[model samples]
Target chain A: MLDQAFETLKTYDWGTDRNLLNPIDEAIVASQADPAARRGLEGRLVAVLKTDVTRAAKDFVCRALMILGTADSVPALAALLAEPEQSHMARYALERITAPEAAQAMRDALPKLDGQMKIGVIGSLGARRDVASVPALAALLGDTDTAIARSAALALGAIGTPAAAKALMRTKPTSAEAASAVTDAALDCAEGLLAAGKSVEALAVYKRFAGEDQPKHVRLAATRGMLACAGK
Target chain B: MNPSTRKISRRRFLEGSAAGISAFSIVPRHVLGMGQTPPSEELGGALIGCGGQGPGTVGGMGSGIRMIAFCDVDRRRVENAAKRFGAKDVYTDFRKLLERPDIDVVAIATHPGWHPLTSIAAMEAGKDVLCEKPMSRFIAEGRAVVEAAKRYGRIFQIGTYGRFNASRDPKQILIHKIMASGLLKECQAVHIKRGGLKVAEWSGMVRYEVSDPGDREWDLYCGPAPLRPFHAHRFGGTHRGYWDYEGGGLADMAQHHFDPINWVYAKDATSPVQVEASAPPAHPEACGMWGWVELRYADGLTFVMDSDEWGDRYDRQTERDVRLEDLSPIDQQKIREMPDPEPLVGFAEAVKTRQQPGGHAEAAHRTATLMHLANIAIRTGRKITYDPKKEQILGDAEANRLVNQPMRAPWRVV
Candidate 1:
C-alpha cells in the first residue's frame, strides 16, 4: 500500500483526490512511535523529491518532511530553496525542522538569492530564531532596498538576542519603513530581554526610544517596557 | 467679562440653549437639523475585509460612527462596501488606510490570519479596534495583540458578546464568583460543547484547482500566512477551511462558544495544562474532521469539545455543572456573602470611555488559545502537556513550534 501511494504521489497534482495518498498519511501516523520508521519514511519522501515530480507532488512531500524530516533531509530540501516555484514550500519545511543544519542551509542561501526569495530565507532564519545567523542578518540591516532592510531589522528583532539588539541600535534607518521596523524591533528586543530576566539590559533598550523624539505610541511602548523592567 | 467668568457663563448659556431645544422639539433629533452630530461626538470608522462580516460589524457600531474609509485585498469588495456605506475612501492596502488621521476606530473583519496584525497596527496608530473573532491564528500572535493593546492603551474587543451576556446571568455570576474567589482549590466541573462546530462543513477541500485572484491583491491577502497559489476556496468565508489561514470550523466558531465558558470558569487569564484529541491525522495544509478534543486545566476543570461530525460522541466524562455542593459549607457561605461581579462594559462604551471591554485582549487571547491548542493536538495526534504560564508545550518541540508558528517574510509578531 505504501509503495502504491508513492507511485500515486509521483504524479499528484492539484485537483487530484487526496484520499489516493492515504497510505502515506497512515505511514506518518504509524511511524510516530518508531524513530527508525520515521527516518525510513523521511528517506523515501526525500527520494521522491529527488525525482522529476510535479510541483504539487513535491509540495506534499515537503509537508510530510515538515513533520518527519531531520538533518538527513536538509540537503534535498535546501537544493530547492533557490528555485522560485519550490522555494516557499522548501522554506516552510526547513523553518520548522529542529535541526541546526536547516538554519545553516537557509543562511548559506541568503547571499546567493535576492528579491522575495532572499526575504523569504531571511524570514525562515528569523523564525528559527537562529542566534548564529544574527551577524549575517544584521549585515543586511543597511541594505539599499527598503524591504530587505526592513525584513532584516524585523528578523533581528525576532531573534531578540542582546547581540541582535545591539546590531539594530547601531544602524541608522534610511527610510520611514526602516525607522518603524527598528523601533518595533527594539521594543521586541526589550520585551525578550525582560522575559529572559536581564532587566538592566532591557531597560537600556527601552530607554533608547522613551524620549520625546520618538512617536507618541513608540514612546508609550518604551515607557511601558521600562516600567516593566523596573518591576513596577 | 473676565475670561474665567465669561467661560462659565458661555457654558451655562450653551447648556441652557441645548436643553431648551430638546424640551421643545417634538420630532426626533436626527429628523431635526439638530440631528447632525458634532465633529467631536462622531467617531471616524474604517472597515478592513469588507466582504463577509465586515459591513455588519461596522453597522453594529451605532449611528455615532461615520464610515470614513474601507480597505480590502479585493478591489471589488472594497469598492462595493465603500459605496454601500457612503465611505469616500477605499484602498487595497490597509497600511494606507491606517495612515488616515481621521479614522478613530477600526473594525477588522478580516480572516483569522490577519486579525492580530491588523489589530496591532490599528492600536499602534491610536485607533480603538473591534476585531472579528478567533482573535489570532496561534497562541503567540494572540499574546502579541494583547501586549499591543496594553502598550498603546487602546480599547480592543473581540467580536463576541457571549461573555457580556454571561456576565449578566445571575446563575453564571454565582459560578464566576465561586470559581474566581480562589477559595475553591480544586474544581472537578466538566463542560461539554457538542456539535454545531461546522467541522464537516468547513473541512478544507484537499483537491482544488488554482484560480486567478481577479482584482484582489493576492499577496497582501496572504499576509502573515504562507504564499500559496490562489484558489477560490482559500479566499472569503471558506478561508476558514485551511490551516494556513485558520483552524477549520473549530477556530471559526470556538471563540463564540468558549468566551462565555472562559468567563464562568475563571479561566480567562490562563490556559489548559493538558490537551488531547482523538482524530485522524490532519492534512498539513488543509483542515480535516476531528472526533473530539479534551482540554484539562490544572485545577481539574475539563472542557470536552465533541465535534459529533465524525465518530461517536465523546462519552468519557458526563456533564457536571459547578454547584454549591462542590464547595465546602464554609466556602458556600462565603460565596453567598460575596457581591455579584461587576457588569461588563461593551465595546462601544469602552471606546468612548477608554475602558476595557468584556472581551478584552487577554480574555480573547485565552479563548482563541483553546482552539489553537485543540487544533495542535489534533494535528500532532498526541496528548500535549503544556505550561500555561510559559505557554510552551512540554517535551514536544514540534507541538511547541505550532504554538508560535513562523510568519512569512516582513511580518514579525514580535
Candidate 2:
C-alpha cells in the first residue's frame, strides 16, 4: 500500500487528486504509537526526496516530515535548503525538527544563499532560536539591502539574548525600515529578558530608547518596559 | 452696539464655531475624560482586512466611531470599503494604517493568522483594538496578544459576545460562582457542544491550481504563515479551510460557543489537562473533518465537542448541564451564599473606562487554546497529555511544539 502511494506521489502535481496519497496519510496516522513504524515511514519518505519527484510530491513529503521526521531525515531535507523553489518548504520541515543538526544545516546554507532565499534562511534560524547563529546574523545588520538587514534585525530580536540586545544597541540604522526593525527587536529582547527574570538587564535595554528624541510610541513602549522592570 | 464690545462678541462666536466642528472630528474619547463620550465626540476608527467581515466589524462599533482608514491586502477590498465608509485613507498594508496617531481605535477582521501580529502592533502603537475571533492562530500568539494589551495599557475585545450574554444569565452566574469559588474539589459535570461546527463546509480544498492574486500584496497577505502560491480558496473567507491560516470551521466558530462555556465553567484562567480526538489524520496543509474531541480538565470535568458532521456520534458522556448537586453539600451551601459574578463590561464601555472587556485577552486566549489543543490532537492522531500551568504537552516533544509553534521570521510572538 505504501509503495502504491509513493508511485502515485511521484506523478502528483498541482490540480491532481490528493486522495491518491491517502495510503501514505493512513500510514502516518497508524504509525504514531510505534516508534519502529515511524522510523520506517520516515526513511521511505526521505528516500522519495532523493528521486526526481514533482514539487507537489516533495511538498507533501516535507509536510509529513514536519510531524514525523527525526535527525536521520535531516540530510535529505537540508539538501533542498538552497533551492529557491524548495527552500521554504524545506525550512518548514526543518524549523520544527528539534534536532541540532537541522539548525546547523540552515546556518550552513546562509553563506550560499542571498536575496529572499537568504532572508528565509535567516528567519528559520531565528525561529529555531539558534543562539550559535547570532554573530552571523548580527553581521548582516549593516547589509546594504534594507530588507535583508531588516530581517536580520528582527531575527536577532527573536533570538532575544543579551548579546542580541547589545548588538542592536551598538548599531545605528541607515534606513527608516531598518531603524523600525531595530526598535522592534530591542523591545522584543527587553520583554524576553524581563520574562526571564533579568529585570536590571531589561531596564538597561529599555532605557536606551526612553528618551525625548525617540518617537512617541517608542518612548511609550520604553516607559512601559521600565515600569515593568521596576515591578510597578 | 459699541465697536469694542461688538468686536469681542464676534471673536466669541468664531471660537464656538470651531469647537462645534472639532466635535465631529476624530479625537479619542479617553483623552476627553473617564465619563461617557458626548454624542458628538466621534472616536477615530480604522478597519483592517476590509473584506466580508471588516466592514461589518466597523459598523458594529456603533455610531460613536468615525471611520478614518481602511486597509486590506487586496486593493479592491480596500477601495470598496473606503467608498462605503466614506473614508479618505486606504492602504494595502496594515502597518501603514496603524501608524496614524489619530486612529484611536482599530477594528481588525483580518484572517486569524494576522490576528496576533496586527493586534500586538496596534496595541504597541497606543491604539485600542477590537479584533475578530478566534483570537489567535496559535496558543503562544494569543498569550503574546494578551501580554501586549497589558504592557501597552490597551483595550482588546474579541469579536464574539457569547460570554457577555452568559454573564447576564442568572443561572450561569450561579454556576460561575460555584466553579470560581474553588470549593468543589471534585467536579463531575459534563458539558457538550454538538453540531453546527461547520466541519464539512469549511474543510479545505485539497487540490487547487496556483492563481494570480490580482491587486493584492500576496506576500504581505501570507504574513506570519509560510509564503505559499496564491490560490483563490486560500484567500478571503475560504481561507478558514487551511491550517496555514486557521484551524478550519472549529477555529472559525469555536469561540462563539466556547467563550460562554469557558466563562460559566470558570475555565478562562486555565486549560484542559488532556485532549483526545476521533478523526482521520488531518492534512498537513488543508484542514479535514473530525468526528469529535473530548477534553478533560484536572478537576474531573469533561467538555466534549461532537462534530455531528462525521463518523459516529459521541455518546460516551451523557448530555447534561452542571447542577448544584455536582458540588459537595458544603460547597453548594457556600455558593448559595456567594454573590453573583459582576456584570461583564461591554467593549465600548471597557474602552471608555479602561477596564477589561467581557471577552478580554486572557479569557480569549484560553478559549482559543481549547480549539488549538483539539486541532493538535486531531492532527497528531493521539491523545495529548497537557500541563495546563506550563502550557506544554507532557512526554511528547512534537505535541508540545504545537503549543508555541514558530512564526515565520520577522514575526516573532515573544
Worst 10 residues of 1 chain B by lDDT: B1-10
Error of 2 at B344 (Å): 2.5
lDDT of 1 at A74: 99
Model 1 steric clash total:
0
What lDDT score goes with residue A112 in model 2?
88
All models, DockQ values?
Answer: 0.20, 0.23
CA displacement after TM-score superposition, residue B393 of candidate 1 (Å): 1.9
The docking quality of candidate 2, as DockQ, is 0.23
Fnat for each predicted structure, in order: 0.29, 0.26
lDDT string for model 2 (B1-414, tens) is 111222222223223332343244435556776555565566899999888778878765655788889999888889999999887799988889887878989999999999999998898777889998889988877877876675455778988888888888888988888789888788878889999898998885764677877878998889878766788888888999888899998898898899999999999878999999999878767899999999999998889989999999999988666788877788788888988888888777666556668888879988999999999998888899987755668888777667766555456564
Interface residue Cα RMSD of candidate 1 after superposition:
15.3
lDDT of the structure predicted as candidate 2: 0.82
Error of 1 at B250 (Å): 0.9
- Per-model TM-score on C-alpha atoms: 0.90, 0.88
